[model samples]
Target: MTGSGHISAFSARRAALFALLSGAFLACLALLVSPPPVPEMKSSAIPPPLRADRQVEPSFVHHFGRKHDEATWFKSDFYYPNSGHPAWQADLIHFKKNRVELEVRRRKVAYKNIAGAEYQRRGFYHYGRYEVVMRAAPGSGTVSAMFTHTHGQFGDPHDEIDIEFLGKDLTKMHANYFTNGREHGGIYIPLGFDASKEVHLYAFEWEPGAIRWYVDDRLVHTATPADMAIPQAPGRLMVHLWSGTRDQFNWHGEPTFRNGARARFYCLSYQAAGDDTEQCSDSYTPRKYRR
Candidate 1:
């Protein structure tokens, strides 16, 4: 009712009006500049894990007839070839045209009766589908094979996956795997056709829970974790031809080195981690992985 009170009330009303307008202006400005809300992507919209149903194109292809030397791709072993006594030579392994040949012959080396040769890929391989197109050698007591193996070192298990052919009969082959330096999961499958007469695609699909073997793309055998211990360590790919001793005659028969023995490989392809698009860039001596 006094003049000063009237003036104060008018000022307060004016301040409240100004504050209301400023807040409204800021709200409108924010709405004008703000971006629209984006919808979140659903889990189903994302890509799924790679499936094992399809056969991927090989990114790593090896044609044995190339000009590269054995040392460039493989390590020649001087150790004994299984049960037979043979010294491996880098010279005995040959690459010509589209074929790689590993020959076994009798040589008088010191006190050892028989001598043979073996070579393994210089690099290590992890989970992969490995395919080798080749013809097994035909001779009594000779064994030709393609396999993946890791030595037990640093308290690690020695793992091996094998596809072996007995020279006594090319119509049958053996598939086996080992875990922790112990052999297990072995099966002998009778191939309908003579492996020595022609080249066929022999392959193994190594996965986490299962391992499958195929001959010419036909599934010949399957090994599960229930069957035996699966290989967990990475290993080198290997091939060799050797004659076994008399004690091993039950598996490879007597070595009749009449004409000698030779295994020929036309091509070898590997799909890393079941992804055919992956390229192999590992050095000759690949990095070893533990467990």
Candidate 2:
């Protein structure tokens, strides 16, 4: 071969090799910056809650107003059913073998006001770790949630943090938060397993400026105040087993329960602002908390 031809071929090969190396380097850099995927572990461990002092005071005053009868009202594990559903009672909430079962069966007498069962904790939790080991019920139109929420009269801003499971699909779950009545952050996380088939620990770390979500102790998602609105008010933790219509904002789908649906809670644990951890129960005196 001529010398010029040999030199031209050698230069072309070197350029091609440089281009390949550059492309590989860029790809590796991108992977390093991207968030890690949800880990596939045989079993994920639930992390303990943070024991830190609260940095901010609660935004709203907690007043235990007009109390209900002693047998049914403000129990730590009991929440009064609102939204036009009043049939919920302590009977529907059962604790056995350290598991809480929030069951909704076909009521023999379908009162116009009774639709489902919901339970909210008595006191409020400000900033800490909220955790639950649960298996969502299986049925469309039904939603199972372990959330913290608070609301005011019409036109007032509200605050909430949620970990919700739609019976429509057990392989996925959704988390959302709101501040001052405006919906801010939301994400759909694939559980990588059937959530109704077994109990899985789901948790969220709540703090002054940030919130993080975890599934079986895996850090799946996180958000900061700059990215989303953070709830400032001290709010009650709640669990719900309710069916919604196609129109509600938190709608899962059309309500359908041939025999009825149920949710099982293996445990609900909370580490509150002062590093106080407690098992949820239904027992509270509203007057004591009244501002």
Candidate 3:
């Protein structure tokens, strides 16, 4: 009887131990099966805004109004750089092998910040006829482009000039002329020559109140003198190239990691467009800059 009682006690103790062990095992298994809760996302901190009237200070007078950073707006092709440069630097992306050879490849890229302040578009610069020569991208929607913008949007209303090419049509390019954001202007031209295959020159003769457009050295579209925006009191100039990858201008649809790559552009020539934005003299029957 004493031995049986001892055996029964041992069995009871084993049962209790087994129960504890099983409970612990089940608890651990449940923990392994469940997923951890995800942490809440944090918002990015915003930067302080620059002062208003002081925006157009001499420190930043000329630049492209189109917002794009050096990396985001432009890439390299031989020597043609995109977007603007710096105040002290001379953005000589225009010349190829020391001569005016505007050739390049323009394809859109994506990035976070495209600040146009540092790379050569903001400062005191005024003068000479400006031209951008290149071929359009092979795809549709948008291809690649170059720009000559000024400090009108950030600072006071200032002069701005642009020579741009779109990828939507291989035979056409766009030109924008403005002073301050108030003076909105642009033109689209269909090239008489084939700019898709070989390189072609996109030229401009910017002389007082007559901003003319040329294709391969031939006059095609002219922005003659009219009471428009350009010819700001004192202005600056910019030279830059870059790519845009937004649905707004993108006809090829937004690029994805899956699609095969494509590029646009071959900037052939670049000439600085100067004081031609002002209202011309009454004696001259200036070409129409606006309707």
Candidate 4:
């Protein structure tokens, strides 16, 4: 009876060991057959082709209100706004009475360190019709400008399209474009009326091969690739108020800040190529040019 009991105990031990080994084998087989999980893809890892469908260009009209739209525009605080000598101060920009005011003040402590204000669109734009309704600042040596500019920030060369007003002459509108930082001589269109006195519609249409400037929807000047290499790079739209030094007297004249100067902007609109929508209406009719 004792021998029979020992045999049964040994048989039970062997069976238990076999069951444990079989369970481990089944687990290993399951792991070998199961599929591996997919790795998460980061947005930066996506290639341009795969991301093209998701990209959208900024195309809209921005009406200046009591406060500047933070989502669509950024007030520049750089030391040199638009590569000019003046230092930009965010506080110099003010919004009141349904328009944006860009102020430029001559510093008494450091007379050379002029304080100016600039605001730029947050998105980069390609070929488009850019427009602004604003009263230019009126002070010799001061410049109130709206333009498109690129500083090689995205592997492109320095290119710019400008609608610049020299406070020295408010009756003349300057139209210029640059490629790779080299200025192609600009033209001065006689506006016949003071740009600083009243709000006017200033616009430029930029295409792949040509550029056209307009004041109150009247064509003032046009340039083609034959005139100069058309800027191919996309850029930001910007407006700034700044003062030039005595060295630029021949161009911008000498800034005399007897009183602080300011430019008032009421609206800005952009229409991309192939878009026919009129984004915004002009607030006032542009004065008839005498010339």
lDDT of 1 by residue, 1-291 (tens): 999999999999999999999999999999899854534434432222122232222347676675755343653634432334465656667777767788887764444466666766555666788888777888778888889876633134688899998877778888999977878844889998888776677889888788899987789999988898788876667788888667878778778755557888766667887474532222111121111
TM-score of each: 0.70, 0.62, 0.45, 0.75
TM-score of 4: 0.75
User: Could you give candidate 3's per-residue lDDT for residues 1-291 as a string of tens digits?
Assistant: 799999999999999999999999999998898754433312211111223232332211112232334422232222112322211111323332312222223322222112111123333334445444344434444334444454533344656666655545556667777755655554778765444454454556566666667665668877655646355433433343233336334432332211222222222222234333321111112121111
lDDT, model 4: 0.78
In order, what lDDT does every prediction score? 0.70, 0.63, 0.41, 0.78
Model 1 lDDT, residue 124, Cα:
62
**lDDT per residue, candidate 4, 174-251, as tens digits?**
999998888888699999899988788899999999999998889999999888899987776789998866667778
User: All predictions: root-mean-square deviation over Cα?
Assistant: 24.2, 21.4, 13.1, 17.6
Clashing pairs in 1: 86-116
Best by lDDT: 4
In model 3, how large is the Cα lDDT of residue 39?
31
* Candidates sorted by lDDT, best first: 4, 1, 2, 3
Q: What is the lDDT for 274 in model 1? A: 43
10 residues in a row with least lDDT, candidate 3: 109-118
Report the number of the highest-TM-score candidate: 4
